[model samples]
Target chain A: MSEVQLTSDLIQWKDGAADWEEAIRVSAAPLLQQGNIAESYIDAMVENIRTLGPYILIAPNVALPHARPEMGVSEAGIALTVFNEDVAFPAGHDNKTQTARIFICLAAVDSDSHLSLLQGISQWIDNSELLNRLLEASSKDEVKDLINQYS
Target chain B: MKILCVCGMGFGSSLMLKMTADKVIKKKGLKATVEATDIGTAGSTPVDLILTNNEFASQLKGGKSEVRAVVNVASEEEVEKAINDFLESQ
Candidate 1:
C-alpha cells in the first residue's frame, strides 16, 4: 500500500464511460468507497447536470462533477477520474453536448472547504500540456503523481 | 461593489471563480466583494456584477448587475480584463 490514507483511492484511470452520468459515477467511486460521500451524492451529481445543463464542463475537455453541499457529503473530498475517450455530457454550448476526457468529481461539505482544491484543479485544467499528458498517461500512479504535483 | 460568482451549484465551481475574481479585484485595488453562488439562487440576489462561465452567463443576464461570461475561471488575467472593462464602462 503506497500511502492510501486521506487522499488514497482518490485518483483513477478508465478506458471510458458509457455516458456523462457513468463518468461521474466512475469518478466518484473512490470517494464513496473511502466513506467520503454517500450514494445520494452521486445521484445529485448526475441530477445536477441533467437539470442545470453541462455547466460542469469548466474547461475544454474537463468536467467538474459536483452538487449542493447538503446533498450528502460527509466531508470535503476530491476525486479525479481520467477517461481515455471522451464521455458525452449534455448541452455545453449552444445546445451541443460537450465531451470531456477528464472528470473531477467533487464532494464539498460546505461552501469554503473545497475552494483551495478547486483552485488547484482549475489551474491544472488550464495547463494544456498536463491535460494532454493525463489523457495519454498509462497508470493510475502516473496520473496520481501528476495530480499531486498540482493539487 | 458586490460580485457573485455563478456555477451549477453555487458552492461547486463558483468558489473557484470567486477565488480568481477576488484575487484580480483585490490586485486591481477595486472595492468589490465576491461571493460564490449556485445558479438556482443567483437570480434573486442583486449585485454590481456577476462572473460566471459561458454556460451560466446567459442564464444570469438582464439582471441589475452586469454579466461577464468568463471562459477560463482560473485565469486571473482574463478576470482582470473583465474587471477593468467593468471599471472603464462605469
Candidate 2:
C-alpha cells in the first residue's frame, strides 16, 4: 500500500466558522499557501457541497471536502482543520444538515494520487476511539501523533 | 461484477469508499471491478452496482443498476456487509 504523510503545518485548530463554506475555506487555506492548490479549488469544493449536498460527510463529525483534480490542483496534498464547535453541511434532499467538527481538505493532482490517503482516513474514521481522540486533539502535535499512529 | 463508488466530487469520499470496497472485495475473494466517479457522471456510467451515501442512493432509486446506500463510507464493516448482502441476493 502507498503511504501518505500528514505534516503539522497542514493542521489547524479554530473555534469554528459561521457555516460550512467558511469552514471549508479555512481548511483549504493552508494548502493554498503552500501552492498545492489554487483559490478556484476552494471555490469548487464549496460549490460541490452547494450542488450535491454534504455527501462529503464520510462519517459523523468528519468531512473530507474536495473537488476534481482539474478544477485547480497544483499538486497532491491534504490539509486538516478541527473546529471547537460544530459546523453544519447540507444533509439530505429535505434540507436537513449534518454536523462536522473535523474538516480534511484534499487536493489531488489526479484521480489515483489520493487513494492511499483516503484509505488511511477510512481506517481512522472506522476506529471510534481514535476518532474521538482526533476530535479532542488540542495541539498540532497531538493531532499528528494520532494520525501517525492510525494512518 | 462492476461497481461504481460515487460522491459529490468523486475525488474525496468516493475514492475513500472505493478503497474500502476494494479491500472488502479482496478479503471476500469476490471477483469485481470497482471504480470511483462523481455523482454528475455516475448515472451515465454502466455498472452492475453503485455504492454511495444514503442521500445520493435515494436519488438513484429505480436505476438500472442496484444502488447500495452506505451509512458510514469509512466503516469497512458496513461497506463489507452491504456488498456481501448485495452479492448474496444475486
Candidate 3:
C-alpha cells in the first residue's frame, strides 16, 4: 500500500468543530479538491453516521468513515486526518461509542482494491499510539510523519 | 468452509481483517476459503462466518450465516480467540 500525504486544504479543521457535519466538511475538502472522490462521498458517509450514530467505530477512538463507492469515488485513494479533541458519534453498539479523533476517508476505483486498502487501514488503526499521534498531529507534516511511522 | 470479511464502502479494515484471517488460519492449519466484501454486497453472496470492523456490520441488513461476529480486527489476540472459539463451537 502507498501513503498519501495530507496537504493544506486537507487539514481544514482546527481544534474545535461544533458537530460531526462541520468536521466532515473540513475533513472532506482536501480529498474533494484532489478529485479523488466525488463531492457527494462525504455527505453520504456523514449522513450514514448521522442516522446510525457511531456504527462504524472500527477501533477504540478512531472511526473510518465511508459510503457506497456508487455514491461517487472516481479514484482509488484515501484522505486521513487526526482530530485534536474527541468527537462523539452518539449511538453505537454496546452503549460503547467512539471519540473518533481520527478519520480515514477511503475512495476506491474498484471493489477488490477497496477491500485491500480497508484491511491495511484497519491494521494501521490497531496501533494505539499511532492513533494517538494522528489525533494529536498539528500539521500535514506531522500527519505525514505518523503515516510514515506506521504505513 | 467459508469466511466473509466485511467493511464500510467495501474497503478499509474489512480487507485488513481478511488478510489477518488468511494468515492466522494458514498458521493454524485450518481449511477455509476467505472472502472479503463491502457490507453493501454482503447479501449478494453466501458465507459461513462473517467478520468485520464496526461500520460494515451495521450495514449488513440481513444475510446467511451460522455465525456473525463483529470484532475490531485490530487486535490479534481477539481475532485469534474469536477464530479459535468459532472453530470449537462449530
Best by DockQ: 2
Worst 10 residues of 1 chain B by lDDT: B8-17
DockQ of each: 0.64, 0.67, 0.43
- Give all TM-scores, in the order shown: 0.89, 0.90, 0.79
Better of 1 and 2 by TM-score: 2
Judged by DockQ cut-offs, the docking class of candidate 3 is acceptable
Fnat values, candidates in order:
0.72, 0.70, 0.48
TM-score of chain B of 3: 0.78
RMSD of 1: 3.0
List runs of model 2 lying over 4 Å from the truth. none
What is the C-alpha lDDT profile of model 3 across A6-69, one tens digit per residue? 3445543357567777666666667788887887888898887766556566677666677777
lDDT per model, in order? 0.80, 0.84, 0.68
Candidate 1 local lDDT, A58-148, one digit each (tens): 7778788888777888977788888988898777546766688888887777655566667667678668788888888887888888766
Candidate 2: true contacts recovered, fraction: 0.70
lDDT of 2 by residue, A53-78 (tens): 77888888888888888889988888
Ranking by TM-score: 2, 1, 3
Better-scoring candidate (lDDT), 2 or 3: 2
Candidate 2 per-residue C-alpha lDDT over B1-90 given as tens digits, one digit per residue, 9 for 90 to 100: 999998887778887888889889999898999998888899988788999987799888678889898867878898988898788889
